[model samples]
Structure formats: structure tokens, C-alpha cells
Target: MMTKHELRREYLDRRRALTDIEVQESSLQIANKVLELDIWSFSNYHVFLPIQKQKEINTQYLLHILQGKDKNIVVSKSNFEDISMSHYLLTDQTKLRINSHGIPEPDQNGIPIDEKNIDVVFVPLVIADRFGNRVGYGKGFYDRFLKKCRPDVIKIGLSMFEPLESKIDMHVNDVGLNYILYGEEVIDLG
Candidate 1:
């Protein structure tokens, strides 16, 4: 088995090879397509913006609509890479921070979560399988968070590439995605 360090390195290397223009164009296209979907138009959604060096999407624009700030504006927070959870209420001002391990802990004011209110959640992944299994940074933060969330919550995995057919070792606690969105396609995991 590869060490965690090696796995991380390989993941980072592959991610870094993607150029800025390519990442931007692909992410924008995917985000646009998602917005055009009926599900996005009809539901309350929470999206997690990626950190630097990872594929960056135009989350701020989406946030504006969800937060009711402006239809055409995109808002992003500072100190994003250091912020835990990177969790902010799409409908409120509250932010939840995530630690280095990817575990989200409510901030001092507590995370304002409306369990039944959330319709969709966009997640980040290093890699994913056709079976809906995702290999995150290996920290299990998203996995743990998903466990505490409502089962009906739509779990969407956002990736820059298509799903890999190879087996990715997953534990029992690992969360499965309901949908996987890639630059090339959007797959329904149901």
C-alpha cells in the first residue's frame, strides 16, 4: 500500500498539472450547467468553495444568488485556505470552520444549519469511482460531516475529471455521492 504521504503527493501533482485557464473554463462551464438545471433553480443549496491550487470555481457568484445578495455577484471570504469547514450558510451569514483534518467545527456563534432546508451540497474530491465512492484528501472530514447530515440530502461530488473505473479502497464510514459532476458530464449516482 502507498503511504499517505505518497498518495497526497501524487494527488497534488496531478492537480497541479492542470493550467489556470483550463481549470477556470472547465469549472465555469460546470457551474453554469448546474445553474441551468431545474434542481438548482428549485432548491436551497450549499456549495463548498475549493482552496488554492485546487480547481477554483466561481462560487462567489453562486453564493450571491443563494445568499440573496445579488443575482450577478460572487462573494468569497478571505483567509479561505486557513478557514475550517469553509462552511458558510448560503442563506445566512454564519460560517463553519474546518480543521486541517477536514472535520468541520461550528464557529463561536455555531453553524446555522437548517437540516431539512438544504437541497444540495457540492463537495470536493481528489478522485472518485463509478460506484460513487470518492477518495478525498484522505482526512475523512467530508465523510464524517455527511454522516451527521440528513440522508435525503443530495451529495454531489465536483471533480475536474471523469470517474475512474479502478477500485478505490473505501471504508464502511465513507460517504457515497448521489451525483458526480465533471467537466465532461454530470452523472446521476442513483
Candidate 2:
């Protein structure tokens, strides 16, 4: 089995190789797949804005869906110093700017939403396995952020490709995802 580091590098290369059209189309498909989930009854939904340069999933489509559903959307601003993220409510007046790392974040803090209030989180990842083990950018930002959320918080990973047949390495501190959305498939890990 490939290590998490190896899987991260491999999947990063694969994602970078995707064309812009592929990314957008796959992201839309994944977003549509999310509709099948029973998570719509939640209020505060935390989602990650994609890192465009890395060819990550275009979460803009998913954001549109959330907006249409009238759910309270929450986005995060990352603190590189502590490797932690501060959650904020994304409002119509919230201005977004790309940070130094190419992540689109709120230019200024909006309504602060505590992690415990988040009912569902749309997590970003390089790749994930059948068991919901994910390989991200090695930042541990989401793991740390998710750790602080309520134990019942729904954690969903968005991916373009299907999960790997083999499980990736897992750490004691790593938080597993509840489900993974890829293409038109939803892999339920719970």
C-alpha cells in the first residue's frame, strides 16, 4: 500500500493533470451527488473554497447549491502560524480575496461561527480511500478544525476520482470522513 505522503504526491500530480473543463464538470457532478445525502436539514454548513492553482474541485458549484437551499454557509480563514482556521459566516456582504496561498478567503472577518455550531463540513482533499481515510496537503488544518467540532458533525470529502482500493495511512489525530462524493458516487464510511 502507498503511504499517505506518496498518495498525496501521486494524487496531486493526477489532479494537476486534469483540464479546467474536467475539474468543473466533475465538481458539478459531485455537487449533484450531494443532493442525495440527507444532510440538507442542517443549518450551518462549513465548506472549503478551492485552491484553484492546485486544480482542486471547483467548490463554487457546491456553494451555489447550498445557497439555493437557503442553508447557512460558513467559510474559513486559515492562520498559518498556528495551522488553525477561524470560521466565518459567508454573507452577501462578505468580500472574498485570494490569500498568499491562493486560497479564497473572507477579506475581513464576518459573523464568527463556532466550530460546534457547524453541522456539516465539506472537506477538501488530495485523495481518499474506501474507508474514508484522506490524504490532504499535509497541513493538518482540516483535521485540527474538525477535531474541535461536535462529535456528530457530518464530515464529507469532495473528490473527482473514486477512492483508492487500498487504504492510506491513518494517524491517531487524523479524523476520518463520514462520506466521500466523487463523480456520481457517494461512498458512505459511517
Candidate 3:
């Protein structure tokens, strides 16, 4: 099995190799797939803004769709000092600033959204396996934040490519996803 570090490097290069047009189109496809889900059933949603440098799935498209539906679009603010992440409602007036890692995060300390209120979480990943195990940049930010979420909250990973057939090197601290929105398909691990 490939290690998480190896998978991260391998998939990050593949993502970076895609043309801008391909990225946008693939992102749209994945976004459209999730739109057909029972998304409206969830009132509060947690989502991530894209990191342009990595060419991640443009979840901005997903966010807009969720926004128009009047779902509570929640983004995050990462604090390296505490090795923790805080969730906030993304609004038109909320300022988004790119961090040192290039991930767009909400700037102002807006009202913190409670974990219990979040019914769904849209995760960004470097790659994932069919079993819903995934690799990000090796930062445990999402993993730590997710552990605190309600046990029944749906955690969905959005990826530009299909999942590898093999399982990932999952750690005890890692949080498994319930579904992966991969390359225009919604894969349910359960």
C-alpha cells in the first residue's frame, strides 16, 4: 500500500497537471452530481473554498449552488497557533482571505457555527480510495475538526478524479467519509 505522503505527492502532481479548463469542467461535473443528492434535507452545511495552487475541485461552484438553495454555507478559519479550526457562516459581507497554505478562509471572526448544527461537510482531498479513506496535505485540520462533529453528520469528499481501488493508509485519528463525490459520480461507501 502507498503511504499517505506518497499518495499526496502523486495525486497533487496529477491535479496540478490538469489544464484550467479541465479543472473547471470536472469541478462542474462533480458539483452537479452532488446537487442531485438529498442536500436540501440538511439545513447547515460545512464546505471549503478552493486552493487555486492545488487545482482542487472548485467547490466554489458547489457553494454557490448550496447558497442559492438558502442552505447555511459554513467555511472555516484555521489557527496554526492552536492547531485547531473554527467554522463560520460564509456570507456576502464576510471577507475571505488566503492563508499561507493558499486555502481561502473566512477573515472576520463571524459567528461560530456549532458542530451539532452542521448536517453535512464537504471535504477537499488530494485523493481517496474506494472505501472512502482519503489523503489531504497531511494536515490533520479536517480530521481533528471532524472528530468533534455529530456522529450522524454526513462527511462527503469532493475530488476531481476517480478513487483508487485500493484502501488508503488510514490512521486512528483519521475520519472516514460517508461519500465521495469523485469525477462526476457520487460514491457511497456505506
Candidate 4:
């Protein structure tokens, strides 16, 4: 099995090789697959926005579907100072601005949502394994953030690529995903 560092570079390279059109089409497919899941039953959800450069899954269409269902859609911004993320309610009027890392972060003025109230979180990842182990950019932000959520909160990962056949390097502090959606499938690891 490749180490987390090696897998990050390899997966990132593969993601970057995709053309803009391919990214759009694949993202649409992944989004459609997500809609097939029973995740909509949850009234409150936390979604991570796409970082175009990182080739993250485009969640705009998914966000619209969630909004149409009257679900409380929430977004998060990195608190660089604390190295932890804070969740905020995303609304029709929520203004978004790109952060230094090129991620579209919600405005700080958004109403905060307590961690316990979130039913599910659509996670971001650089790579994930069949065992649900995930490797992000090594910031440990999501690891810290997920720890605060309720024990049964469903943690889902949105990946443009499928899970690695082998397990990823998992540490005690790393938080594994319960489900990972990639291409046209949602692999439930829970």
C-alpha cells in the first residue's frame, strides 16, 4: 500500500490530468449518484465546496437539490488560527469568497450551527481507501472537526476517483468516512 504522502501526490496528479469538461461531467455523475442515497432524510447537512484547482467534486448542483428539499445546508470555513473549522448555515443570500488556498469559503457573518445538530457531513478528500480511511491535504482540519460531531453523524466523502483498493495509512487521530461517493457509486463503509 502506498503511504499517505505518495497516494496524495498520485491521486492529485490523476485528478489534475482531467480536462475541465471531464471534471464537469464526472462531477455531475457523482452528484446524481449522491441524490440516489437516503441522505436527504437528514434535515441538517454540512457540505464542502469545491476547490476548482484541487479538482474537488462540484457540489453546486447537489446544493441546489438539497435546498429545493428544504434541508438546512451548511458550509464551513477554515479557522487557520485554531486549525479547526467552524460550521455555518448557508442560505440563498450567503456571500462566498475564495480563501488564500483558492477554496470558496462562506462569509463569517453566517449563522453558526452547533456540531451536534449536523446529521451528516459531505467530506472533502485527496484520497480514500476501501476501508474508509481517508487522506486529505495533511492539515488535519477535518479530523479535528469531525471529532466534535455526534458519534452517529454520518461522515461522507465526495471523491472524483474511486476508493483505493488497499487501506490508506490511518492514525489514531484520523477520522475515517462512513461512506464515499465516487464516479457513479457510493461505497458504504459504515
- What is the C-alpha lDDT profile of model 2 across 1-190, one tens digit per residue? 7888888889899998999999989999998999999998899999899999999999888889999999999999999999999989999999999999999998655889999999999999999989998999998999999999999999999987899888788999999999999996999888
Reference-based TM-score of each model? 0.71, 0.98, 0.96, 0.96
**Candidate 3 weakest lDDT stretch, 10 residues:** 34-43
User: What residue runs in model 3 are displaced by over 4 Å at the alpha carbon?
Assistant: none
Q: What is the C-alpha lDDT profile of model 3 across 166-185, one tens digit per residue?
A: 99989999999999987658
lDDT of 4 by residue, 1-190 (tens): 6888898899999999989888888878877888878777789989999999988888987888887889999899897888988888998788899999998999999998998899989998988888898989988999998999999999988888878888787889998889999886889886
Strongest candidate by lDDT = 2
Candidate 2 colliding pairs: none
Which candidate, 2 or 4, has the higher lDDT?
A: 2
Q: What TM-score should be assigned to candidate 1?
A: 0.71
The root-mean-square deviation over C-alpha atoms between each candidate and the true structure, in angstroms, is 5.5, 0.8, 1.1, 1.1
Please give the clash total of every predicted structure, in order.
Answer: 7, 0, 0, 0
Clashing pairs in 3: none
Rate residue 12 of model 1 by lDDT: 66
All models: lDDT? 0.62, 0.92, 0.88, 0.88
Most accurate candidate by TM-score: 2
RMSD of 4: 1.1
lDDT of 2: 0.92
